[model samples]
Target chain A: MNVVEVTNICKTYPAFFLNRVSFSLEGGKITGFIGRNGAGKTTTIKSMLNLVHTDSGEIAYFGMPLIGHETEIKQRIGYSTGTISWYPRKTIHEIVDVTKTFYTHWDEEAYRRYMTLFNLDESKKPIELSEGMKVKFNLLLALSHGAEVLILDEPTSGLDPFSRDELLELFTTLKEHGVTILFSTHITSDLERCADNIIYISHGEIRAACSKDEFMENYGQPGDTLEEIFLRQEREERK
Target chain B: MNALLKKEMRLSAMLLTYLFIGFGLMALLPGYPILCGVFFITLGIYQSFQNAREANDILYSTLLPVAKRDVVKGKYQFVILIELCGFTVMAMMTILRMTILADSPVYRQNVLMNANPFFLGMVLLIFGLFNVIFLGGFFKTAYSIGKPFLIYIFAAFLTIGLAETLHHIPGLSALNAFGFDHIVLQISLFLCGILIYAALTWLSYRKACTDFDKIDL
Candidate 1:
């Protein structure tokens, strides 16, 4: 069963347009949503989450429409953006205190565990944290709630290598626990490491969506890395 | 809804603090009532403009487990709460000042300036118009605040200016004096202001929900 099913979603901006994009994520699988800058990756993700209104399309979670079931769907799906700027003056503890009120299934013990694991300072406000720390805090909030599907947009953009690896491992553990993930990033190495599926988008259109093994088989030669495949795809698309 | 309101309160607590201080100061001035009213409405508009500039509310609230409509509802509730608090604070401070100056007719004269029901009604009308225009323009796109903020400010100043000028005219001044004498007329005008406030609150919420739903974050 698919965790998320997006069908023919279209959104138009003055300078860009996402034209009839469609993709589906299988349950308990990690799908890498790949696109370069100016490639409508964020727009597509935001559309799926209904953060952005689409011009035309249907998005569903667990076979229910996103429009009518937005509150329910969002409750079960945790989302994190690349830039994590909440109330600048709010401390981490205050933020968590306020945030936990929205979710009926909030796990305070899991929240404390993630805070300790991430070494987040509860007394510090968001503005006091470095970009990487902010990202970690956001990830903690996302994980604290019993979210079944995590829609993370560039969740590791600013993390150190060790922390990034730790987060990647955490994603694997989540998958093992039957939680699906739709990870968006331009970093191909992260995708190569753990993604079971890849959804490539370019110029506001979906270029390809398939399993990582099939992606590598179709595009890679012996000793060719995921980065090489991404570069080759970029070069091919330019032509 | 409670969750959203809690977040908004936390986010805007500093603004509310500043407003409380500003209103407290306004009540001590000789031109207390009208200036207090002006400050009250301006504070609301200014804080909303500031929120739009920050854009953090949109970022955080949209990520939460609430519908777009609830966000709008929560925002309207927040604004109304702030306005009511401002009104209460200013009213209390003004009344306290009035009590302190009971021995001085000159001070009482100053207190009576713009203290009539017609003037109070105009203040309410200005606030109601500001909300209708501001929230209507704001939620239409929910992106840029400059255009909407400027549009509402222009309308607000012009309306307030015209209302004040109209109040000074000979015929209206007579009506104002008449309203000041008759308790029933004064009560009726105050009730009219309340009615407009209630209608605008509902209208603003409805408009905000509609406009917010169409917004692309």
Candidate 2:
């Protein structure tokens, strides 16, 4: 079953537009939403989450319209944003306390375990924590909710090499537990390691969608990295 | 709604401390009959503006399995909760100041001044103003499509100014004098103010939910 299905979604702004974008994430699979900075990847995610209004289109989660089924849809999904900010004064424990009221499947033991693993001091305010720690905190909250689907936007934008590797391992564990993941990022290395399916978006459109093996077979060379293939594809699309 | 209300109440508690300090300083002066009233009014307006600036936090909030209307309602309740808390604190301080000043010989000569109705009138006026300010501000913040603080300030200044001017009129003075002793009239006006606020709150919630539905995020 598809966890998310977006069709013919469009949203126009002054300088950019999301034009008739469509995609889907299957249950028990990790899908990477790949696009350049201005390719409307975030816009597409926002539309699917109903954060912004679409010009025209249909979006469904578990075969139900997202408009009326927001509560049900959100209950089964965990979401994090790239640029979203948390209150500076709130400690991780306080944030967790508040968030616990919203989700029925919240796992206190899992949350505490992640806190220990991430070395997150629940007493420290969010502003006092490093960017990597903040990201880890966000991931912990999403995961501890026991959500069936995780929708992360640029979840690894500012992390050290060690932290990035640990996050990938965490994602693997999540996938093994039957949780589907749909994440967007400019970091192709992370996607290559963690994503099973790829949705390549460029210029507000889906340039390609395929499995990781197919993506590698279609564009790979002996020494070509995913970044090189992406650059080459972007250059060809500009012509 | 309870979670959101709790959050707002906590924020209100923090803001109320600031308001009390300011009001306490004003109480030190003599002949400040309207200080409590103006304080509550200004505090309500300020809280509404601050809420508008922080509206983007709703992106994370809306992720919960709650209706958009509930989110908007939660916000409106927060504003109202702040207004009530601020007013209650101000009222307590006013009574305290009145008792302190009444015991002092310097203020005995001005005992009639102490009986000024402006504080009560100001409370009613501020409650009405807060309703209007919150409704206008929330609509702008939710839509992400307008100047929320500007609308709030304009409405607040206009209503307060107009109400103050009309209260000073000769004809309105008679209505005010009669209302001082008429329990029914006082109760009716109070209820009217509350009903108007409730209606505006509902309207704001409906608009915000519709706006959220349209948002692409």
Candidate 3:
């Protein structure tokens, strides 16, 4: 079953337009949503989650539209836009404790597991954490609610090599547990590490959307790395 | 709804509660516009917006397991809750002044707004305008706070100046009446103030919720 399906979503700004963007995340698989910074990856993700209002679209989780089911859908879908900018003065324990109150199926076990794995200090405020720790904390909040699907935007952008590898490994582990993930990033190497599927976007349009092997096979020479395929595709678009 | 409001209070409005508590005592001042007390209370509430913006609260909150409208509802509820708490303290002080200090020269000879039903009425009016002007302006963009609040400040002081002078106008001296001097009229105006505050605030809450619904966050 598709965990999330975004169909014909569109948004427009004074300078940019996301044209009829559409994709879906298969249940329990990691789909890397890849694009350059301004190629509408964040805009598309936000549109999917209704964080960015769509000019026209239908977004469904478990086949229900987002408009009326925001609370229930959000409870089941973990979303981290790769930033923890709220409650800078409050402790992690304080923010997470309060956040858990909003979810019906909060998993204490998951919370503790991430807390231990990330080596997070609950007493420390967000300002006190390293950039890596803040991202881990953002993921912890997303996962603590027993979310069936996790949509992370640029989850590894600011990480050290070791931390990035750790997160990619965790994404693989999460996939094995049947947690569907849509991981958005420009970091192709991180995607190469674990993503089973690829959704390539360029110039605010989808360039490639397929299984990882098929995406490589269809878009570029068979042995090309994901980064090579992306550069080639972007070069073609600029032609 | 309870969860959202709780979060707003615990995280968003934490330190600001002391502002509400302390400013209500501004009602006890012997000779001040006293309406300016209401302005300061509104300013205190404005500080919550500053903190929320700095923390990017609207972004985090939209991701929570609550409807987006509920987020706005939570904010409005918390703001009104703080206002009500301050109003309660102000009311207690007003009652004490109306009774114990009824004939005290310190209050009687005071040349500014008195703590009375009429004063309380204007307080509600100022609060009502805060909701309409500030909150209504805020959710239109969901991020900009300065211009809207500046507009509110202007409206607030204008209302304050008008309120202070109303009692001095011919046949309107009853507005500044001392110790039940015009108890019936004062009480009626106070009731009208209550109705106006409730109506205006509820309308502003609805408008804020609507504006927030269209925001991209």
Candidate 4:
């Protein structure tokens, strides 16, 4: 069964518009939401989460609608944002304790493991931590929730090479456990390394979506990287 | 709700401490312990307003599974909690001042003026008015990106007008009809204010939740 199904979603603003966007994520797989800035990736994710109201469309988590079933859907879906701003005075432990109260399936062991792996200081205030550490803390929170689906937006934006590699390994492990993962990022390399499927969005529309190997085979040239393919697709769309 | 309340209390603890100090200072100035009460009450209202702003944890909070209504209710609960703590400190200071300056001739007159039923009523009225203004202003500001100060000013005027008119009505004037000698009356008025605040808080929560549902995020 599809873990998430988004159909014909549309949202319009003065300068930007998302037109009839559609996508789905199945169990035990990873899907990459690939798009440049202003391509409506975040908007689509927000709509799926019911954080952004769509003008038209249907979104389902499992089989229930996202609107009235938000709390239930969110319980099973761990989410992380690109910019993780937290309460300045709260320490990581305090945040973890608070989050634990909300999720019934919270995995304390997983939380402890992530803390050890990331070298996160539980006693330090969120404001006192570095940007990468903040992201790591957020990732830990999202992962330790024991969620069936993980919706991460730009999870590798500011990480160093080592941290990024560590995160990729973590994702591999999560996938091995049969957890569905949907993440949006501008870093095509991360998608190439970890993503099983790609949903390429351009100008608020889905340009192409298929397995990574199939996408590479169809559009990728000899010595052509994913970045080259993305740029080429974007350039072609503009023309 | 617990998380939101803890976060708000931690951030507003300093403001609450300052309010206590202000009440203590007000009590020493003379016969009018009621003036001290009024001063502390207004300060408490202002603190609630400030706390509301400081509790804007939208980015992280929106990710949580809780409904938006619960988030708004948590904020109102925080404001009420702060107000109650401030009121308690102010009441203690008032009693202490009353005892200390009981025999002072100069303060005797001041005390009478401060303790007048009308004066106390007006203070309560103003506080209720401020609560409405603060909630409305915060909601208006959250909906748009324009000048919130102007929206606050407008909300203040609207709240003042509505509260004053409501208090002037025959039946609803019970809010201002507290008799200092009658403990029951005082308790009833206090309860009435709390009930009104609770109702408005629920309404505000509903408004916020519906607005969030309609918002583009």
Against the true structure, whose DockQ is highest? 3
Residue pairs clashing in model 2 are: A51-B216, A51-B217, A52-B215, A52-B216, A52-B217, A53-B214, A53-B215, A53-B216
Over 4 Å off in model 1, which ranges?
A: B16-18, B21-28, B31-33, B48-52, B93-104, B107-112, B174-180
When 1 and 2 are scored with lDDT, the better candidate is: 1
> Quick one: ranking by lDDT, best first?
3, 1, 2, 4
lDDT of 3 by residue, A81-159 (tens): 5665568898998898889998899999989999999999899999888787888989999888888999998899688
The local lDDT score (0 to 100) that residue A36 gets in candidate 1 is 88
Best by lDDT: 3
After superposition, the stretches of candidate 3 with alpha carbons farther than 4 Å from their true spots are none
lDDT of 4 at B122: 37
Per-residue alpha-carbon lDDT of candidate 1 for residues A1-239, written as tens digits (9 for 90 to 100): 89789999999899999999999999999999998898989999888889888989999999999999999988898988658577777788888888899998999899989999999989999889888888888888899999999999999898888988998999999999999999999888998899999998999999889999998889789789888988898899999
True contacts kept of 2: 0.51
User: Which lDDT tens digits does candidate 1 get at residues B1-217?
Assistant: 4777777776644564345535534544554445445545555546754763474777678778898888877767776766666555555654454355434454445523444455456556666766777666677876666676788677767865675466467665532332135556656876797789789878887988988887776
Point out where model 2 deviates above 4 Å.
B10-30, B33-56, B89-122, B143-147, B154-168, B175-192, B211-217
- Supply the DockQ value of model 2: 0.47
- Stronger candidate by DockQ (1 vs 4): 1
Q: Which prediction has more favorable TM-score, 2 or 4?
A: 2
lDDT of 3 by residue, B1-217 (tens): 5888888877887586556566877788888878787887888889888888888788888888888888889888888987888888899889988999789898899888889998898889999999999988999998999999999999999999999888778988889988888899999999999999999999999998888988886
* Top candidate by TM-score: 3
lDDT of 2 by residue, B13-109 (tens): 2454345434423433454444345544455445544543453446656777787667666666766665565556555654554455445554443
Candidate 1 accuracy as lDDT: 0.77
TM-score of candidate 1 to 2 decimals? 0.91
